[model samples]
Structure formats: C-alpha cells, structure tokens
Target: PFPSVALVGYTNAGKSTLFNRLTGAEVMAKDLLFATLDTTQRTIRLPQGRPAIIADTVGFVSDLPHELVESFRATLEEVGEADLILHVRDIASPDSAAQAKDVEAVLEQIPTPDGKTRRILEVWNKIDLLEPETRETVVGQAERLAREGTAAAVSAWTGEGIEALRDTIASLIDDDPETQLTVEPHRGDLLAWLYANGRVTGRETDDDGRVHLTVRLHPAALGRLERLYPDVID
Candidate 1:
C-alpha cells in the first residue's frame, strides 16, 4: 500500500502553500481563515522516489462551528488513517506555540491503531515571514530536531528546504513488510540498521563481500534504509 501523509495545523498556517509546494497542487492560498474548507489530496514522490499520498486537511480554527466540524469529519478520519502527520505551523506567528498546542489537542482526539501515538513531524513553516536573526534561530531549532528525525523547517512560499522536508517525511512513515534484501558485506552500517529495525529471518554472506538478508521492517526504518542505501539492495 502507498504510504500516506496528512498536513494539519491551525488556520492560516501556510498549509496551502506547503501543500502546493509538495504536491504541485494549486490549492487557493489566502490570508483569510477557513479558505480551505474541504480536504484535498495528491500523490507526491518521496525523496526515496517512492510515491505517497499527501492530504491537505481543512485548517483548524479557534472557534469552529459545529457544522464546520461535521463537514470535515471525513478529513479528520483521513488524518487518523495517515501513515504520518505533518503538523504544519506558521513559525513566525506570535501565538505559534499556543497554536501548536491547540493543533496537538486536535491530533490527540484522532484514535490510532492499537492506541499507539500517531507518528507526527512538525513542519516549522513560514520562516520567510521572520526577521533574519529570528529566521536563523527558527531554522536552527528545526535542524536540531531534524537530527532526531522529528521535524523540518521551511519557507514553503519560497521553496526553501522543501527537498529536505520531503526527505524527512519519507523518513517518518511507519509500515511493515516481510521482504528480502541484500546488503554488501562492507556495509556493516546497513546490516546494523536492518538488525536494529527489523526481524531478520535469514542471512548468508557470499565470498564476494555481499551479505544476503531476509527481514521484516516496519515501514519508517525500512524507508530510511531504502533512502539512505538503495545500492545495498540493488
């Protein structure tokens, strides 16, 4: 199955801009709230060249009408079905932190399979709206989180860091496959990751410095493996 990602955030967080940048869709981006009342989705190529569906969800508002909630019920359920959730935020907004908390509150209501916490990645977007010094700080914080594989920073309007964001989202999807892949004997790093992230059912090393492995990887780690080291399998 194709992995899916859902974009969710407080209203006017530049999600439409990010959505357009990611999927090449022309969702009308407006400064006004509730501009995107309906959810939109498109298939986009992840950095690893795998295709995944990215959903642009209706933005959340502070005082949403009950009818508005009813209208977006399907979108919220899509969020629940997503393999990854990108919590897009207007990082330059004055109330951004609280806005993030509110978005988090909504995500909390979405039940997950087996009640596991839904995998989420914070998209710290709209850094272009910040002052130079502040932009540096915001991007720096995002890079730190990127190291942990949890967040990304970008100015979706300007296209800055969009590639990295795509890579990060690919790095965060969760899935499992009973599959076979070969690792070169020289690539101990790949072997370690396979062992750490998946259950290895079979292995054999050939004299030509190649190691064959049969493993089951839950998707996120498998994606990282494929993204970072495709040649090992090839």
Candidate 2:
C-alpha cells in the first residue's frame, strides 16, 4: 500500500480539477457548489515514479451542519487518514483567504489516523483565472512559498505550473528505496504488477527466459512482492 494524499478545500475551489489533473481521473469538476459529495480515490505516479493513492473528498463549507458532517463521516475520514493534506484554494476568488481559513477550521475537527493533524501544503489553484499582472504577482508568491516548502501554484484547467506541483508532492513523500529483481518469463503477471505498482527504471531479457528489472518501490509494495516471489527478488 502506498501513502495516500487527500485534497481538501472550500466548495468550488478547484479541488476536483486538481484531483483530475494529478490522477487522470474523471470526477466531476463544476463551477457550482457541492459538485462532489462522496469521496473518490485514484492511483497515480508521483514525479519520482512511486505510486500513491490520491483521494478527493467533499468540499468544505463554512459552518457546515453537524447533520451533514455525520452523514459524510466516512468521506471526511479520508482526510484524517491521508499521509499528506493538500489545501486547495481558489487563488482568484475574492474570498480565497477566508476560504482557506474555513478549510483549516474543518481540518481542526477531524481526528487524523495518526491522532494529529497532518502537515498541509497549500495548493494555490485556478491561476488561469487571474489577470496578467495579478497572475505574475501570484506566481511570484507561489514560487516563494514553494521555496519554503509550504505551497504550490497551478492552473488545473490550463496545466500551468503543474509539474512543479507534482515535484513538490514527490519530494514530500519520497522515503522509499529502489531494488533490483529477476523474474522468469513464466511469471509475466508479476512483471505487470511491478509495472503497475512500482517504478521500473530498466528491464532486460536474457536468452534463459529471465527478466531483470531495476525498480523503485514503496516499502509495502516491496515487502509484498518479496513475500510473493521470494526467490525472484535479489
């Protein structure tokens, strides 16, 4: 199992857009409120080539009703269990700062899996909607924040500054180590699983029907593979 990332923000803040941009998922991203009610999970490769689970949860609303919170307890729990929390904000919105405050307020009420609030990285999204001069100012601010390792600025619609955002995520959760493995041709299934779950840097086939691979895998994936193909992994 890979570490999970949860996207959290106020309603209509482009959290869903960023989710789709990062994971290639098709979750609805609309201009209206409450577009996504339930939580959605998707697998994606980090910039460093490690696989991870990315989750998009229902948007946060100021003074959210206790009844609705209770109704979506399961969905909101995903935020608490996340290894990383991305606070997506609509930078172009007039209430962007207030929206961020609201998101933080909701996060405070969550009981995280680790019994503490996870570290949050601000995602200043919707830069595409900014005016030229304003966009330049915002971009500079984002760059400064990124240098401090606190935020990333991006346009989910126009795909601007997305690579930088991905790199930031990769740097945050990149504690996994690389390993080499050798599998027989008959174990094609294993090869496919490795490709899907790990980052395969190189592969070669020998005349003896052996496939050699260099891969970077999360510890959980590495352990599982070792257990399944003990003799194959070096």
The most accurate candidate by lDDT is 2
Which ten contiguous residues of candidate 1 have the minimum total lDDT?
Answer: 170-179
Residue-level lDDT of model 2, residues 15-47, one tens digit each, is 998999898878899876678988899989877
Model 2 segments beyond 4 Å from truth? 115-117, 182-189, 201-214
lDDT of 1 by residue, 25-54 (tens): 899998877788778989887653456789
- Give lDDT per model, in order: 0.81, 0.86
Alpha-carbon RMSD of each model: 7.7, 2.7
Give candidate 1 regions above 4 Å deviation.
Answer: 63-68, 174-234
Quote each prediction's TM-score.
0.73, 0.85
